[model samples]
Target: MSGLRDLTKTKGDRLAYTATSSSTVNRRKRSFILSGLVALFILVAWLSGYMIDPSHLSTHLELRNLPPSLVHPFGTDWLGRDMFSRTSKGLGLSIQVGLLASACSCFIAAALGLAAALGRTADAVVSWLIDLFLSVPHLVSLILISFVFGGGMKGIIIGIAFTHWPSLARIIRAEVMQLRSAEYVLISRKLGKSRWWVASRHIFPHLLPQLLVGLLLLFPHAILHEAAVTFIGLGLSPHQPAIGIILSESMRYLSTGMWWLAFFPGICLLLVVRSFDTVGEHLRILLDPRRSQE
Candidate 1:
């Protein structure tokens, strides 16, 4: 009787484990599908904006200040420019800037993070720099940096790249520190393998997922900051039709009751930002072992 009871318990445990595994697999599939859909949406938006002709955005005084309609989906701006075109172009530009900035920041983070693993002194210096950057507000630091660089696409990208790396750097540093103690790494060290060889061969492959997620997560922040600085006259040129410039210019006409001027563009920016954020979060969950099971 006792043997039969044990057999039943083992079967129950197996069933439970199978159910959990199934659930995890389903969750991962859903996450992957959602991420793919959001990514496709972003790609479409970027391409539409990138490919639009300048002539389509030319001012039409007769169509100025129109509200959202079937023909003008997002409506017309005060300058008679199609807000849809302007928003799309602005979002595309923002995405491009965000990509560059995030990639640059990731490079910085990876370099400093790997360097931190070299020695106690290197770790301390990297930690201090991380803390120093974190101590200040991002927007404030970004503005100062942009101003220093004379505030253009170049300034904005450089400013964002410099400001965004500390958080990701800290993550990479912690990951490397933990990885350093792993049995494989320790054994490689004992086998007369150089530190650089071990890091290149064993460590970097593990860091790639974290780096990719970090890049996606940093993108939204970069876009928002770029828009903010530009809105206040410190980012892109006024003639550039950037979202910031759109919002800033819209302010003057808001009291006159043209809501779509700022409304559509602002909403579009938020949508793009949230889409990237969602993709990053889903990728992070998929990549993380502990969270993947949940």
Candidate 2:
């Protein structure tokens, strides 16, 4: 009778284990599919930036602004340059702006947030300064800063970096506050670990999971805002190859029935932003220590 009871228990455990494994596998498979699509989109955008071999086209008005067809896949623009090439180059610049601005934001948010969480003294000082910066509308603030700093790519980078750090800073401050209360921190204190040592070894690692997510999420926003500032003629120089330049230039050609100038670049911008969000979000979920696949 005891042997029979053990056998029944074994079978129930196996069945439960099998169900859990199946569910975990299904979730991982779905995540991979979504991550792949986003990765492919980013790869294409990266390639578009410099996949050009200047060895291909030459100066010619004869082929200018040709419609999309077999010879030119994405059509041509007013300058007789291949729309495909210009798009790839324009996307490259936007990618540069996104990444550079994001790096600046990550560092700024981490330092200030961590500082604020160190104690009430540090928190009060940092909190007051962050709130002051957060009070104004971001776009207005960006333009105002640009007007001061010569209103070019440099201005755009600086302005975006300034305005975008606050959200992540606030989130990081909250995360740090929670982490400071965790038992491990108290244990480290009991063990005689220096405050800075404890923060580096214990607190920062826990904060990273959310910080990574915020950085990627901020990327798409940075790209869009950069393009907007550029479009208004207060950001990057008009002559530079940029999606905003292409879009702004298209307005003049609209009455003449040339819409491809705006349409193709717009699609590229949207897809790139979507991929950043999806892949960044999925990666964050995977990296989260407390998040379980099942």
Candidate 3:
């Protein structure tokens, strides 16, 4: 009778544990869904504001430097331009640059990584190049590259795209190399299938997840670097309504007690970058099978 009671208690404990674990998982899933929806809403709102009208951000001397109020939610800058409008436009432009640069960088990494995995000679050369690029400070390299290209939107895009690929390329090359040595790849080779054909049909599909994750991770870096270069006067033109330009212009007026000029725009930039980082982290967690178990 005691043995029977002990067995029943053990079974009850197991059921309780299972219920608790399931509840925890349900809560986490709900949290993830809520986070995703909020991020999407913020993105859509910003995009709508960006596409609304350029005239909205135009200078209005009379409205200039107005403090935050119902009339101007983010207040007005020294030039009397709507701070909210300027911030949205500037952030939108930064997103454009980040998307372009991140895409280009990913393409470069994928191409070089595939090339390296295709041959030993190519692998050695690519490895050396990766090392060379990594040896230099990214900012210094970005500055030199941007300055050489005349320091504007074009320069910033090209500079960021070229400088950001090395680490990703290394990761991709290692993954490809491992895949190349797998049994199926070996069998495909033995069956008279060309390396290019196998890689295109098999390897590329496997690479998509990694490539996507890398692209998302690269976005925040690209945006931040673009702003940094612009702030240091080696990036986009001041005439452009970029976050860097807005922040740079705000510096001169900060001492005059127009703290909103810098504070609002800077905070907005940080929020956008952080949002991208969060999305990327969540994406990685979702896509990784081992992490999904956790």
- Best candidate, TM-score: 1
**Model 3 per-residue lDDT tens digits across residues 50-133:** 685777778789888898888788889887888888888888889889989999999999988888767789899999999999
What is the C-alpha lDDT profile of model 1 across 78-183, one tens digit per residue? 7788888898998888888889999999999998988876778989999999999999999999999988998899999999999999999999999999999999
Task: Please say which candidate is ahead in TM-score: 1 or 2.
Answer: 1
Worst 10 residues of 1 by lDDT: 111-120
TM accuracy, model 2: 0.89
Distance from true position, residue 40, model 3, in Å? 0.8
Model 3 gets an lDDT of 0.87
Q: Superposing every Cα of model 3 onto the true structure, what RMSD results?
A: 2.3
Error of 2 at 23 (Å): 2.0
Per-candidate Cα lDDT values, in order, are 0.92, 0.83, 0.87
TM-score of each: 0.95, 0.89, 0.91
Better of 2 and 3 by lDDT: 3
lDDT of 2: 0.83
